[model samples]
Target: MTLSSMSETGTCTDIINLRYQDGSVGSPSKPQKFNYQDFGQLKQTYLRKGRLFVDSTFPPDYKSLGNLSDLPRSVRSRVEWLRPSDILKAQNVKGEPSFFVESASRFDFAQGKVGNCWFLAAIASLTFQKDLMVQVVPTEQDFEDYAGIFHFRFWRFGKWVDVVIDDYLPTFQRELLSVSAKTRNEFWVPLLEKAYAKVCGSYSDMNAGLPSEAFKDFSGGVHMTYKLKEVHDRNHDEVLWGQLTRATKCKSMICSGTAQKGDTIVNTVADSGIVDAHAYSITAVAEVHDGSSNVRLVRVMNPWGEKEWNGKWSDESSWWNRVSSEDKAKCVKRDDGEFWMELEDFCQHFQILTICCENPNFIDGDVITQWKVMIYDGEWVAGRTAGGSLSNSTFSTNPQFRITVTEIDTEEKEDKNVLLSLMQIPSQRYRNDERLRPIGITVFETPAGRIENSFFRRNSPMKRIQLYGYERDLIEQHSLKPGEYVVVPSIMKAYAPGKFVLSVYTKTETSIEPHHEGEDDDDDEDHLILPTPPKPVVPAEKSSVYDIFKSYADQNGELSAWQLRKLLNETIAKGSSDLFDWSACRTMISVVDADRMGRMTFKEFSTLWSKFEDFKKIFNRSNVSKTGTLTYDELKSAVQAADIELDDNMVWLQYSLLQGDSSISLVDFLTLMLRMDNMAKKFKDKSSDGFITMDWNEFAADFMFI
Candidate 1:
């Protein structure tokens, strides 16, 4: 799909287009149903039944543990699944065993046996933003009314899905086995982890990941990551420090991870007391006045609840004596896994820094700039839209979006105005079942018209945004000129089907539309061209159509798409030497496949075949020049003659898609009509009150086969 945009003068507008291939724009709306499970009804049922809720969706069996062979024999044998109530009893709680000891904070939990420090680090950062934390871990949840069920919401793709799970957590030797709290009775840590694990497919699925992945899931916000080593090497410490200060002021979630030294294993403590390959949250950034000068300091917290940094500005270091009493009071020294380190030492030890926020105002420290965001939900169907990278001939088939940047940002010296983010949505329910494809986006400067295969073949891309690795998300900032540009996102290989969410954040007002084929450039009434009346089919031709249908009809007097294909190839299509393939036949059946049984009765087949004959007559009559193709205006007439009512935009979209050079071939025109009819019928059948709702799998099943 391709999108085209135009500039409009007004306050910043945020548009969210969801769940449709048509390039319609609108604001975001709530999904009528939640993914996986519904929380409210489930909880109420359990409460009314007077029984604890045991999630059959994610049971306490070994399946939920995911591959027990990866676990140590002793730990695997001793592992026991226990609910919060049972665990509290084992701990001998005096009073009520609360879900949380107090308001959730960074110090509330410690890392467990799972190698998900990346996730824990994001959680640790999440603790600082109360609003986001509440969104992820709803505060109303508690053990008092708990029905042995807990629910947490995480941003999945473009929506927030409530993930519900039983409170049953994996334990060993009567001790909490996952993310334990600092206080003995608090259970939020493990419960939250369990819910996330369920979302990832199983506990093992959450074993290792990037903090940015968890950060995006936690807040569904803009993510920005910096390589500390690169920043230090470029002598951009001040630039990075500025970003950190602004990020902290913006209340963005921040996290960093230490580099793994040569031949060193993860979590291994080095001489400086920093753990390798471990994630840590940046709690604070300060410029403390040390008697002689001001020292840039960063507060880092290890999720382990220990292993404090022993370098300069550490709790035990003599560097603290140089700071003023007021500064020292502000920066407390403790052995509780958190320590302040000099900015230089911090950069030297940490390899990556990630910050996430709902808005990206923190970048460039431009607090007043309100960016307009446009989000689109799209998919790459294997044979249809998944047209791989630039190297492939089918590259033009990839989804294309048009962005028209009407104005430039004068506030910034640089022309950088747009931020493009392409995130692939997982088709599977679990992490282990899905593989991240190497995806990238290509932006092309084109003429003010529909982009086609010829355009791509003739022109090189203006810019190619390549993600360094096969990552789930790719983000890039660009300084595009004020004009119409088409953005194409694709996997490195063709025919790899997947869904994706594309977000465009721009400083200036811009219109974004999916540059679908057959869409018309003009909708003006004066410029509209209606198709000529079709030449009447001879009585003999009409009689022969019925004769062919009767021959293909089975004992039940019904013909499947396959049978219809044979009938057409042997009859009307035989004269023109044009043969319909299985795909075209399937589409033809879907046009009248009311029962969706892939078969059509005589009545349905007669109606479809008559329309086909009428369309063929109109196709020939419209081709007055006898060029063996129909111009855009001629195609519109043929469509109308066949009683396919399409608005100017829809007509243009279809015309653009099938047109070669400046016109559509007879084969392409017929295929377009079949597709339009099939799509229209499917839409009417599936839509309810003008809306169609489907999960990823449902959408794939309904649309992919045809």
Candidate 2:
């Protein structure tokens, strides 16, 4: 089949060859299916094209610009607009193709829902290759008038590509096409068919797909430089133009075009006195006159409707970069959409945040003398200057393209002033001491000099996570990437330094039940446990390696009767392992039994002397020595073997032995053990029916240090 558009007829394949540098001659991707409400939302936005109401007090996201004065003058004043050479250098710094645009933008689209920013961006690129916009026309095949048909072709890369479109821009009233039952298919059906028949000629027609998807069908010919090919069909969106400007690699800075359906109009950035500012757009400039005005003057309707400079060529503004401080006067404020400025100044300063949106009041009656005004973002290599300095610290200077700040909390102790540190964890490991690399936020408790758990930024921000106050359910914890963080909760909790657990969620109580053997775990195969391993029976007698040590201790110091019994068990089960190996002590068999006390806790265990064993070797070997008790020197040597760091436990143990160097005598040791046994039994108090006491092994674990 053959198709013709703009005086060119060709096969489907022939049309595919029309690709341009930044324009795609290709068909776009198919649009995703929109539900009724989603589609309605889009339509409603178009209907509500009212003037902007910028609220400067709010954050950037919520603020609307009052006028040029309310714009981010700080940014605009400091960062000089990039020269063509600068743009070219910044071009593809990240290795991506960029159409340098600081040289072209004339007008910007204000905050509107129109997706025309992209169209404007494309227009910017088009100017580089010469009259690209006027080259395309919509015609029909096997028919005339081209009423419902469109044979549109645009130059992309270096070629012209044809696309047949049938779908009318979606309208507000679906009922517009619902002309009763009699004319049901008459209006919309003919409109759609005629639209399609014209574009593709006798072949397939209608560009009914996602922007990216349509491009894919057109392939290399039409999408030579548009690079819509890189964006996935599913993620392609009409709002992509704004995001593109922010994206470093999409470096095409300048853009211009008429507003369309899906564009967003924002307040003026030019007014903000900041480059890359936001503003509103009112109407389009169809034609113009010449004389005193060097550049054309397009009439634009401001959202604030505040009349700044309303005249041809905007004699009030510093247009052509030629307005002297003395010549230019302050702008007057008004409350209507009517505002006039030179074409270049109007376009270069404010960027239309969105693509073109429909001007609900555009006059077809009398060609109103107006400009298809645009609001575009300004260029900035550094943050806007406030006084003589940049706003966000020294200029980034391209050290890195992205910067993220995070706050970390430190544990609180029950005593001094404490501070919190916010550090950016580098992906790779290296010592970072640069003051700029990290900063401190000293946390102060409410109503006083007290402190609390470390917060993201220790300082009190205007809007914070809201904890320890009326809104204290503080469940919105952040999931930080794994790395080192810093915090000093309060003087009491001084500094928080440790590897914290990765938490999934926080609740008042866990409430989940522990798994019990033989229980069917909801029929999920997880209930299947491996066969129970037989319990090992350690020998009751026959002194092992530990007995030898016990004998030495006996000769050295009297072994308490309880210690003797532990010696027997240690000899049989553990051989000569140090009694204080972290793992062994933690296993519930080390301390209490050796101390002859069936109960133990960190405080109680503090009084006892301990011997250490190589913690690492303790696990490598089997039973025996798994829970042997050692004396002062022996303990020190054993701990060294384990590669364990000496902690408070080791010191306390040594202190006990030095305090009493009495050698063990069987009789005296037996008496001490007997008393310990009685004390253990009494403390357990078996009389409390359901309340159970932990066994000897558990007692030992109560004081185990990991």
Q: Identify the candidate with maximal TM-score.
A: 1
- C-alpha TM-score for every candidate: 0.70, 0.19
Judged by whole-model lDDT over C-alpha atoms, candidate 1 comes out at 0.74
**Where does model 1 exceed 4 Å of error?**
1-35, 68-70, 262-265, 464-468, 520-706
Steric overlap count per candidate: 25, 130
For model 1, residues 220-256, the per-residue Cα lDDT tens digits are 6788889998998999988998888777877688899
- Model 2: lowest-lDDT 10 consecutive positions: 1-10
RMSD of every candidate to native, in Å, equals 16.6, 30.7
Q: How close is candidate 2 to the true structure, as a TM-score?
A: 0.19
Instruction: State the TM-score for model 1.
Output: 0.70
Give the distance in Å from residue 435's predicted Cα in candidate 1 to where it truly belongs: 1.6
